[model samples]
Every structure is written in structure tokens, then in C-alpha cells.
Target: MRSYRAQGPLPGFYHYYPGVPAVVGVRVEERVNFCPAVWNTGLSADPPLFGVSISPKRFTHGLLLKARRFSASFHPFGQKDLVHWLGSHSGREVDKGQAPHFLGHTGVPILEGAYAAYELELLEVHTFGDHDLFVGRVVAVWEEEGLLDEKGRPKPGLALLYYGKGLYGRPAEETFAP
Candidate 1:
């Protein structure tokens, strides 16, 4: 096993990964809700799986515990402001459902204007140190009609990437080079 420590110049720190666009939605009783999440990834192709990490303290976390179904919506670059608004605010104090949202297959609320969205059923839950890892099976997926390119592939707009220290970012034009 490899040992790890958080001290010294080469401390055991994970470099920041580029943020991917995602919106995590869950239903708590009759209320369907969702929040913007940056920590989401595709787990597998065979089982068609995906996963998102949610802090235990988030309102969506409680909702996820109650409802086994959720949706992950990907916003286009144009929706960056909306994603930021949703991420910065708390669901407990705001009613996101009141905003523009559409009902997906699982009855989960999905923002209608997103670039694309996927409905998922919870397959398993793993408790991590400060967040819960939600593994889900993709049940359905759809994309905006005009958002696809000539090859019928999704042409996603700019993505809103997250930086750890309360800062969000978009792609930098000339920062990194191959």
C-alpha cells in the first residue's frame, strides 16, 4: 500500500481536475429538486453507470436518501450563470422547482433549457468521509434537438468548471498548451 501525508512541499494532494457540467436532481416526497454538481463522472459503459458525490450536509443528500431516483443535467456554456446561481444558493432557502424545469421519466425535475439530461436509478450508495458516493444506472437520456452537430452528436457549449476555494471558472483560452 502506498503511504500518504498532507505535510511537506510534495504533500499528498490531488491536483484539481477540470470541472464537468452536471446537475444532480432528487425527489423528496412530492417535491422534486436538483442542484448543480461539479463532482460527477461516468463510472462504466457495460452497466451504463454514473456517479456523483454529494456532501452529507446538502439538502439534496437528504432527498437522495428518501428517493432512489435522480437526474443529472448538463448545462451548455450559456447556462453558466444559472449553474452558478444554483450552486451558490441553498435549496432549503430556495424553491428551484418554481423556476423553469421539466419532468423527466423518473418524475425528477430537470432544467428544461439544459444542453442535455439523464435520468438515473440509484443502484448503490457508499458513505465516504464527508460525502456520499451515489452510484446510479442510467435509465434514460435525451438532448436538446438543436444542440447536436451534423453527426448527431452533442455539441456542448462552454462548461462551467469549479475551483475548490469558492471560485468557479470557464475554459481558459491560452493557459495550458500541449
Candidate 2:
């Protein structure tokens, strides 16, 4: 195999695709919005911190800054269309209230039928390049009944994985011990 040398600028940054897409929900006053976030991860174990990076131009960015709270909902692979729709559309244009969701412990909308959902209180906001990383402290979690095994791992459902460029896929159900 051959490798290429570095270039002045990168074409795109999604070589790291196939990550579980998160539907981030935020509400400031009565204005609630939902947006799909493919760039989210756990930041810390202690204090239970999580972070989702959002571009400043996105509507969710401002709402999150004001609300200072959000919910991250993870649906099954079967709901991939919903995930795509949320990402493709803008909250500034669409109502987004038609999506099936309910209020969480902190009053943030949590998507209904999610395999798992997390309610987080905003802890800090860090600016990195064009995106702002909204760091949050996990305050509550909702897990679907019977979805997790005794070890607290999700059973055999396919996870909704984003592959960038409007494509989506899922991991095989087969599991192995490392």
C-alpha cells in the first residue's frame, strides 16, 4: 500500500465515521429544538461529563448557550430516517415539535423510543476552531426496559451509526470478547 504526503488543507474530516448519532435536544423558554449530532463523546467518568460540538451558526448552538441544559437521545438503527431528517433540516426552519419526544427531568426534550437517553446540565463551553464544545454534567439517564443485559450492556439491537455524506449503517449483531 502507498500513502500520500500532507496537503495544505484537508478535504473532509469524516474518516472517523460510523459513530452513534445523537439527537441533541434543547429548550429555551417554550422554543424547543432538536438537532442531530454525530460529534459527541464522554469527556470524564468522575463527575460524569459529556460533550457535543456544535457550530456557532447552528440554531441549537444559541439555544444551548442560553438554556445551559440538553438531552442526548440514542435511537435504534431502525430509526435511521428520523436521524437523517433531523440532521438534514434546520430547527430555524422547521418546528421539530412533530418529532415524538417528551420532557426529561430537566425539562429538555428527550426523543421517544430512544434506546437510551441522557439529561445533562451544561458545565462549560469551549471554543475549538469553528465549533463550540458544550460540556455537560450528566444528571439523569433513561434506559429502555429490557434493553440492557445483566452486565449493563445493550442487547442485540443494531445501533444507528452515521457514515457521513448522508449515509448510515449498523454494526453486526455478533459479539466477541476481546
Candidate 3:
């Protein structure tokens, strides 16, 4: 492969995050909204904080900022189509809850297909370049019952890993390695 210097603000740079799980961002305001996000990760364990990077231009950003509470659904295998659909559309245009999504106890929309999810109350919104990083304290966490092993560590191969340019898949595993 040939090498070239990276340029400014290129979407191609996002492709570097291969195998990052797709995440669904949910917020409720005048209308409930769900947006697919790959730019999210956990920040703390003791305080149970999670951070999601979102552009101010996104419809969900305003709702998240206004409500100061949001939920995140981590996509598992077989749910990429829904993630793609959510990422492609703006919540300002349509009701995403019309799809097969349910509300958590906090009334945040939770996709039925989530492998793991967290309901969080906003702690901070800090600016970073073009996007704002939302930090929240996880108030609740949900997971598919069989997703964990006897020791509580997640078994490999069940996560939906996103590769940029609209592609997603699980990492290859040695079938015999287990």
C-alpha cells in the first residue's frame, strides 16, 4: 500500500475505527429521537460515565442538550441495517420511534435489538473541534441475558463492529480456538 499525508476534515479518517461497536443515541424532547453513532465510548468505571461525540448539526444533539438525559444502545450482530437507517435519516424529518423501539424506565427510546444499553443522566457537554462531547453518568445498564460468560466478561464474537463507509461486521474468530 502507498502512503499519503492526511488532509483536513476528511470522513475517510473515520475508517480508522474498525471494529468499534455501532451505538444508538436516544433522547426525548418535544419529540423522541434516535440516531446511530459510532463515536461513543466509556470514560469511567467508578462513576460509570460514557461519552459520545456529536455534531451540533445533528438533530439529536439539540434534543440531548435540552433534555440533559439520554440512552445509548450498543448494536450487536444482525442489527446493522437498523443502525444504517438511523444514521442516514434526520430525526427532524421522521419519527424513529415508529420502528420497533421501546422506552426505558426514563422514557428514552431503546431499540429492541440492542445487545447492551445504558440510560444516562447528562454530566457535562464539552466542545472539541467540530463536535461536542457529551459526558453522562450511567444510571442504568441492560444487557441480553446470555451475552456474558460465567465470569461476567463478554464472550467474543457477538458484537457488531462498524467499519466506516457504511460497512459493519464482527471480527473473524477461529472456530476451533474456543
Candidate 1 C-alpha error for residue 85, in Å = 1.2
Q: Scored by CA lDDT, what does every candidate get?
A: 0.77, 0.88, 0.78
Model 3 residue 95 CA deviation in Å: 1.4
Per-residue alpha-carbon lDDT of candidate 2 for residues 107-161, written as tens digits (9 for 90 to 100): 9999887888999999999999789999999999999867667775567655788
- Cα lDDT of model 1 by residue, 72-92, tens digit: 987766776777778888889
Candidate 2 weakest ten by summed lDDT: 2-11
**TM-scores, all models, native as reference:** 0.82, 0.94, 0.87
Report clash pairs, candidate 3.
none
Candidate 2 lDDT at 9 equals: 50
Best by TM-score: 2
* Top-lDDT candidate index: 2
Sort by TM-score, best first: what order?
2, 3, 1
RMSD of each: 4.5, 1.5, 2.5
Ranking by lDDT: 2, 3, 1
